[model samples]
Target: MRRIGFLGCGKIGKALVRHIAEREDMAVEFIQDPGFINDIGVQCPVLAKADEAAFAGADLIVECATAQVLSENLELILAHCDLMMFSVTAFGDPDFERRAKALCGTYGRTIFIPHGAILGLDGIFDGGPVWRQVTVETVKSPSSLGRQDNRRSVVYEGPTREACVHFPRNVNVHAAVALAGIGFDRTISRIISDPEVSTNAHRISLSGDGISITLDISSYAAGAVTGAYTPYSACGSLDRALGNGAGLRFV
Candidate 1:
């Protein structure tokens, strides 16, 4: 069985922990969540810090933490073990991609990126020298947008690199698009807030040589109190990508 270490206990992390706990092929050996150390409360072995030492005996470290955690803990995670990151938006950082790749090379560890909320990625890399572009239109309720609550609004539209800076929370799709197609600067992204939409809707359009594809996904908030995306839905794509032996294509 594969021994897994989790770096967060948020919606996605908790879901992954439950999923792994039920699996015969994998075991969650350690969980790290500084904010909720007491809240997790004997669910599994918990760690206080996000560091290589904390993850030292695990086969794979899965990061379901926030973007900030990705930025801070990425190096430690990479140095200690194989890593699969769900916070794909962190790749949008100017030096993140370069540094991550370098660490992977230096430590001889694999870094996996799971396709969080983008689509048409399998078809994006079907051909040669593929010059691709992506545009994301996220329509979410004002409550989801936070602060802006009055009317439907276009929150942002620009290169993925710039968009990541403005909307870190929503950049996973953009980062996934950038990594799958070209790079962050080349990929386009847009965010919209619509009060009429009760669910978080993500629409992605990809155009390249001889092909233009689009995907529309509407994800409802899971728990009533938290109002976050369903962990199963976000992590489902990751499970598929990992289980199918597809290398970071969907991530």
Candidate 2:
């Protein structure tokens, strides 16, 4: 059984913990979430905020925590084992992104960025150097955006970096798009909170010298901030990252 460590046990993390609880192929080593509760039947050690040293026992540590947590323990996590990142928005900071990649080299550890709550990430990544411009326009229910607005409103608009700063939890897909396509500074991010939309929607537009492509992805909400499909995405990412060898990787 693969020993797995979880950095957070929020909605998505809890869902994944339950999903793999009974699996014969994996075991939960420990969990480090301040807000974690054992509502489900599965049992594991709930680590404190300062006990990251326990991570050395994990084959792969899944980070379902916030960008801030990831940033704080970047080197420590990489020193222990491979990491599957849910908070891709943390890379919105060019310095952090660069440092993370460098540490992956230093520690011979891998950082896996998951395709969360969206599709067509492969094509976006394949565009690579040819990508001159890229934009991710996301729409979420007003409640999802932490607002009570009854009508549609553009909550944020700017470079992907700034957008991630403004709406870290909500517009992570845009940050993923930026990483896969052009870059944080070049990629455009537009976030809309609309009561009319029944799903969390992301529309990606890629423009290059001779190519123009658009992709639209949508998912229902399981919570105000968690997408119904996100937990499954995390599971899939974990499966793919199980035995990865060194360096930065996208799952």
Q: Give the TM-score of candidate 2.
A: 0.92
lDDT of each: 0.70, 0.83
Clashing pairs in 2: none
Task: Specify the poorest-scoring 10-residue window by lDDT in model 1.
Answer: 221-230
Candidate 1 ranges with C-alpha deviation above 4 Å:
37-42, 222-230, 233-251
**Which regions of candidate 2 fall more than 4 Å away from where they truly are?**
243-251
Error of 1 at 68 (Å): 2.0
RMSD of 1: 3.8
Number of the top-ranking candidate, with TM-score as the measure: 2
* Backbone clash pairs in model 1 (N, Cα, C under 3 Å; residues 3+ apart or in different chains), count: 2
